[model samples]
Target: MVFEYILKQNGIHPQNDLTIDQSIDFGSTAAAFAGGNGDFTVEFEPGATSLESEQKGYVVASLGKDSGYIPYTAFCAKKSYLKENTDLIQRFTSALQKGMDYVQTHSPKEIAEIIQPQFPENDLKTIQTIVTRYYEQGTWKADLIFEKESFELLQDILLDAGELEKRVPYEDLVTTTFAKKAVK
Candidate 1:
């Protein structure tokens, strides 16, 4: 949704302006690009770096950077479940805030070292580069609050993509109480 949204924002019509071969699987997109399948490919992390390192493609644009604040990692629960589990939800949001705070305070190299075990195949530099890119792009929001503007923008994207039949009001779906309390 964001990729096509970004394309539209850049004055390029996704379906009319160019060919988008989404037939390629998610994980195989970078590989397909490396194999010379498309002129451009949208990738995350290792895939983007791998493409650049292998000289297959250059990282020209950032969909996230231009897309604005998106709740890339979000927690969802039924209203009843949330009302019943307020304490648990608060703790979870608080923990997420702590991690976000850590990222905001620490350097990319330090973060890379801490998470190195998760990606043993990738070197410290690669992890650092990816972290640096995310940092530079302001990928991590200061707080976990999915604000009104962002929510609406995301809805707009979904609507444009025909994934949503009607706009869902922000108040109807989102509650920033936990996130706000966590930030406090």
Candidate 2:
């Protein structure tokens, strides 16, 4: 969705019927599904029950391209909620940090093993490859840096598409304090 927003900022609409048919190859998964890319050629299978078919002509790009986590719990809150529910926000922030810590500390092999039995048809090496790619770009930021960047990129696209009427201050859209607090 971030990339889609960025593309729109650049005046490149995925659904625009232009002479050129450019595809944004987002592989299948739950998030991708929600972001409106679930119909893409590649996707994650549930329970590894089916034979893995290698789809030709599709480029495989890792989602961890500049990967990082957004503290939606902190940034997505209404101003009133943030002001009144700091402790709840902090606890959610801490949980995200813990998950990131686990990912950071775990080896690709271990992670592969953990997820492998459920998806037995897929290769462990492939899973490990995905896990490593995620680790390389991923970080848990309570400040929501990546999400802010994504939104900024999206806003730019919206503006280019004339979907937005004016410039929105990026700093006004997201908070950085929670990430700063969590890191400390």
Candidate 3:
């Protein structure tokens, strides 16, 4: 959906311009591209960096940087559950906001050092490179707020893809109250 939207935005018809190999699963795309399966590939984070580092692929483009605002990650909970656990949700959201703040304020290498424990398989330098790439690409926001404009853009993408039958209003699915009140 994202790739198709990007293609259309750039005046390229996804269906008519080129054949995008949808056969490769998300995880295997880097390896497949490395094996000469596709002319180009869209990868996120470590995969792209790893590909270039391994001399299999070249980092050419950034879809997210070019795609505009995307509300890719959200902390979702059932309304009932949310109502029952507002305090817990607030704390969770607050923690996430802090994480965002940390990413925004710290250098990529510094952030990488702290997060290296989470990804033990990757060496510190690789983690730093990945962090630098994401940081440079503006992947992380300084806050946890899911803006209405981003929601609308997502709906537009979904509508263009024929995945959404009707446009859902942002208020119906989003609430910025928690994010707004989240401890800074």
Candidate 4:
């Protein structure tokens, strides 16, 4: 959807000029593009970075850097669950904020070494590359607040893609009350 949004911004409608071939996952998409299965495919890091490093695939654009602060990931829960587990949510957010802070202050190589246990299959160099790219791009946020402008950009993309019939107000969908409390 983001790639489609970017294409529209560049005045290239996927429906008219480009053939959109859907892939099951990012790695497969990168592999397909690298193998000449498609001219282009949208890939997220570390898959995108990995493809360029290992497969000689060229990156035409970076969605994160180019799109200007689109919030692609979020820690979400059901309304009922959230209502009941507010404290737990706050603790989780606080811990995440601390982790984000650590990443922001520390070197990407150090952060990668700390996280390498979770990704045993990937080598240190690949992990370092991915972490460095994300860190440099400001992909991770220390604050949990869902920025209204970023949310609106996501909504606009969805609306343009016909996934959303109407614009959903930010207040209705997101609450920063717990995040605010967590930050403090």
Candidate 5:
């Protein structure tokens, strides 16, 4: 959808100019591109960084940097679970916000060291690169607030893709109360 948005921005309709080739996985997509089967594919994180490092691929553009604050991740809960676990949710969001705060203040190397234990199979260098890229991109939000503009951009993407029949109100899609309190 982001790709479609970008294409449209450049006055190219994806349906007309692009041939959609769906790959089951990033590795396969990279492999296909490397093997001359396709011209380009979008890759994320370690894979994208690794490909460039190994001289297998080069990035044409960074979607995150170009699009600006697309809100890639969200915490969701069932209404029943949310109603019953408001305190738990608050605690979790608070901890997450604190972690974001830490990332914002610390060097990428320091942040990588803190998370390296969980990714034992990945080498320190790769982890550090990923962390550095994310830090430089401002990928993590210190505040949990779900911005209406970002959500509306997402909705526009969905609508353009024909995935949404009509615009959904922000109030219906999100509850900002907890996020508001969490930031405080």
Candidate 6:
């Protein structure tokens, strides 16, 4: 929800004029293929006005009231490998930063063109909707200000999920050095 916080901090209301909703199904490969075509015969439609008793259609609904949140998994890197190949980590991070920059600067139509082919079933409109929402304000901000409120919210969610034993202090978990350099 870092995006939400950035917008809110700048007086952009995510909840007031606009509504927040997740995809019909969380990262469904099949649904992605059938996007907005009403072709799934099973997948829900985009912004569906009403539900039918028995018919192939889509459903527009709140992300909440869903069964469970997506789980967070950790991938550990071998300490020896990391220590010997620090450059690999740096390169990967740099590449990601460059990609985020490209996405931010490109027009939505341009971005849409690049993404459309991946999901042949999804009309350009559906892909556009997803891209606009995810990359809304632009740059993924690899070095953007590490807003404590955002992390705190994440920690709270994890705690509620019984994933965290005790909350860590902001200083222990995040650093602002990169963000400080970014604005300069």
What is the TM-score of each predicted model, taking all chains together? 0.96, 0.54, 0.95, 0.89, 0.91, 0.49
Report how far off residue 64 is in candidate 2 (Å): 6.1
Error of 1 at 138 (Å): 1.0
Best-performing candidate as measured by lDDT? 1
Q: Which pairs, if any, clash in model 3? A: none
Top-TM-score candidate index: 1
Q: List the residue pairs that clash in candidate 5.
A: none
State the lDDT at 153 in candidate 2.
Answer: 53
Q: Tens digits of per-residue lDDT for model 6 on 44-132? A: 23322112222334443222212122212212356576577666755654554566567767877778789798878777877676566
lDDT of 4: 0.82
Q: In model 5, what lDDT does residue 66 have?
A: 71
Per-residue lDDT, model 1, residue 133, is 93
Q: What is the per-residue lDDT of model 2 for residues 49-131, given as tens digits with 9 covering 90 to 100?
A: 12122322233443224222323243487889989988888787767666666666778678777878876666777677656
Residues 83-120, candidate 1, lDDT per residue (tens digit)? 99999999999998999899999998998899889999
Off by over 4 Å in 3: none
Pairs clashing in candidate 4?
A: none
Superior by TM-score: candidate 1 or candidate 5: 1
Give the candidate order by descending lDDT: 1, 3, 5, 4, 2, 6
User: In candidate 3, what are the lDDT values of residues 1-184, reduced to their tens digit?
Assistant: 9989999988999899999988888999999999989789989778898898899988888888888879888878889998999999999888888888888889999999999999888899999998898898888887888998899889999999999999988888898988998844
Indicate the TM-score of model 2.
0.54
What are the RMSD figures for all models against the true structure?
1.0, 7.0, 1.2, 1.9, 1.7, 9.9
